[model samples]
Target: MTETAATNEQISATLVLPYLNHAVRMYEQKYASRADIDAAMRFGCGYPKGPLTVLDELGLDTVHDQLAARYAETGDNLHKPADLLTALVGEGRTGKSDGRGFYTYANGEVIADDETPSADDQPQLRHDIKKVGVVGTGTMASGIVQVFAQAGYDVVFVGRGEDKIAGVIGGITKGLDKLIEKGRSDEATKEAVLGRLTGATTREALADVDIVVEAIAEDLDLKLELFRDFDRIIKQGAILATTTSSLPITQLADATSRPESVIGMHFFNPATVMKLVEVVTAPATGADVNETTLALCAKVGKVAVSCADRSGFIVNALLFPYLNDACLLAESGVELSVIDDAIKAEAGFPMGPFQLLDVVGNDVSLAIQKELFAEFKEPGFAPAASLEKVVADGHLGRKTKKGFHDYS
Candidate 1:
C-alpha cells in the first residue's frame, strides 16, 4: 500500500513501473520508433527522458533482474520482462555504461542519432498540400495557423465576424512580436508570415485549401456539423483533419463521403513548443491519407506518431492514469508538494501531478479520465473524488485563472 513516507523504490514501482512495462511491450511490437516512444513520453508526460532511454541509462540487465525477481516473488504477469529487453540483457549489452541496450552508447553517453530513423525510412507521401484552412479563432486555432504560416504554407482561418477575426490576427501578431523581442524573429519575417495568412468568416473561403483542420468546440455534435459542412464545402481530394484530443475519428468521418480522407492531428498545448503530434487513424482512413498526414507533420517540423483512434492516443493513454492516481494519493492525505516533489525529484518528471493538473485544467483532466474509464472500464481510471470537486467548483484551469491552485 502507498504511504506518506514511501521510498524512491516504492514510488518507482508504483508510479513508473507500469509505464515502463507498457513502453517496452509497445516497442517490442513495433508500434512506433524507439525515438518516437521516448519522445512521446517526454513531450506527452513532461518526463525528463523516455522509458527506453531510462532503461538504457539504468542498465537493461539490472531492469531485467529486477523484473525477474519481482515476477518470481509475486508471480504477477505485469512484472514479466519484455522479450526484447531480456534478449538484450542476455547479449550483455546492459546499457550506456557498457555501450548498448535499447540504444548505442559510447563513453557513457547515448549516440542519439544511432536510434534516429533515417530519411530513406520515411512514410509514403500523399497530397502536396500548399494551403491550409483553420476553423475557429481560439488559442488552438491561432497556434495552428501560426505553425502552418511559419512553415510557409498559405493559411486561411475562419472566424465569426470582423472583430473576432481581427482578434485572432492580433493574437498571432502579439506572439510574433514576442518572438521578435527575443531575437528569434524579425519584422521582415513577421510581415512575410502575416502576409501568408488570409482571414475569412465562411466555409466558401476554405474550399480551395488542400487541408482543412477543424479546431472549434469539443462538442461532438458541433464537430459532426462542421465535418458535414466541410464534406460538402472542402474541395474533392482534400485531406480533412480534426484537432480533437479524445473523440473518435470514425465518428467524424461518418459525416463525410470520403471516410478514407479523414484523420486526426492532435497538437499539444501551445503547439509551437511541444514537439509531438498524435497522427490518429480510423479503420476507414486510407493508407495514403495516413502517409500524407505524417508527411504534413514532417513538413511543419512536428514529430508525429501514428496510432489507432483510441482514447488518449499513445501519450495520453499512458500519462493520464498516472496523473489520476496521483490525485487519489493527494486526497488520501498525502501533501500535494510531497507527491509533486517525489515525482519530480525522485521520479524525474518535469512537473508534479498537481501542477500539471492545474495547467491541464482539472476539468479537462477529469473529462479525459472519464473518457478513459468509459473506453477501458478500468477501475484505476475512475476520476479522483477531489478532482471532481475541483472541476465542479468551476475552476477549469488557467482558462478560468484557478483550479488545484489559484492563478496569480
Candidate 2:
C-alpha cells in the first residue's frame, strides 16, 4: 500500500486504517464499548481517534465488505468480518452514510451520550460473588479490598495483628482520600466503601465469604500454604483466588483439595486504578468457578480476560520483554531520555518503556522477567544486567523514590 506513496497521507492511512478496522472488530467481540475502546486508545496509546470512531466516520459497511471479501479470497483470519459487523450489514445499517453503525448516526454526526453494554444481556451467572475475603495487608491487598468495597461488596480484610490491620484500613482510607481530592470519588462514597470493610486477623473470619483472594507475596510455597488453609477454612462451594501476577496458577490450585474451586484473579497494581484483571483457569478449574469469577469482575468494574494458567498470563507476558529490551538499550550506553522521548513522540505510546518500568517497580519487573525467562528459557527474555543492579541498589521505583528517572 505504501509502495508508490508520494505524500505522508497515503502512508499514514495505510498504517492506521487497518488498526481502525481492528478496533471495530474488537467492539464487535464485546471487549469494550465503542466509547471506552476509543477513550482507552486515545488516552492510553495517544491515538487521535478510537478505531471504532474512525470506522464509524469511514463507514462500517465499507470495512465489513472489504474484510469479508479479503477473508474469503485470501483465507486470512485478520481480514475476517466481525460477526456484529456482518449482522449490521445484513440489517442494512451501514454507517454514517446511512445514519447507523457501531454508533447511532444522525446527520453525519453521532449522539455524544455514552452507553454501557446492558448487563441484562449478559450470560447467566453460575455462582454469585456477593461477599469476598482478602488475605494480606500490603498495597495490593488493600487496593483489592478497596476495589470490592467500592463495588459495594462486603469485604473482610485479614491481617496478622491489630496494628497491621489498622494500617491496611488506613491505606484504603488514604487511597480513597486521594480519589476524592482528584474528584474521582466523594465523601459519601468513601464512607459507604469504608463501611463495607471488616477486618480480621485470622482465616476463621473468611468462613462465611463467597470468595477468598490471597494477595500476599509471590512465593509458591507460601501461596500453597495459604491455599491449603483457605481450602480448610472457607465453605465447600466458595471460590479461591490468587493475585499473583507471574506465578503459575496450576501449582497454587494443586495445593488445595478442591482444584475446581481454585482460579487466578490477577489484579493489576493498585487494583482500584487499573482496569484489567486476568481471570485464569487451570485445567482442573470448574466451569462454574470460572464463570463466577468473570461475572464478579464485571460487578467490580474491571475488564476481565480469560487466559490459561500460565506464567505472566497475558499483560505481563507481553509487557516485560519490551521493558527488558529498554534496560538493555540504556545499559549499552544509549541515553534513556532519547529512547523515552523518541518512542513517545514517534510510536505514540502514553509512557515510554522506562517510565513504565519505574511505575511497575524494577524489583517487580525483574521478578516477572525472571519468571518469564524461567518458563520460556529465551536468552533475549533474560533480565537485563541494569535491571538487576537497580533492584540490588534498592531503587525499586516510585515506591523507593528513585529508578530509571529520579522521583525524589
- Name the best candidate (by TM-score): 1
**Tens digit of lDDT per residue, candidate 1, span 143-241?**
999999999999999988988789988998999999999999999999999999999989889999999988998999999999999999999999999
Whole-model lDDT, model 1: 0.84
Clash count of each predicted structure: 0, 0
Q: How far does residue 265 in candidate 1 sit from its true spot (Å)?
A: 1.0
User: How would you encode candidate 2's per-residue C-alpha lDDT over 203-320 as one tens digit per residue?
Assistant: 8999989999999988888888899899889998999999887778898888888999999998877687777677888999999898889888888888776667766665565457
Task: Tell me model 2's lDDT, rounded to 2 decimals.
Answer: 0.76
- lDDT for every model? 0.84, 0.76
Q: After superposition, how far is residue 26 of candidate 1 from its true place, in Å?
A: 3.5
Instruction: Please give the lDDT score at residue 216 for candidate 1.
Output: 93
TM-score of 2: 0.71
Supply candidate 2's per-residue lDDT for 293. 90
Q: Give candidates' CA RMSD values in order.
A: 3.1, 7.7
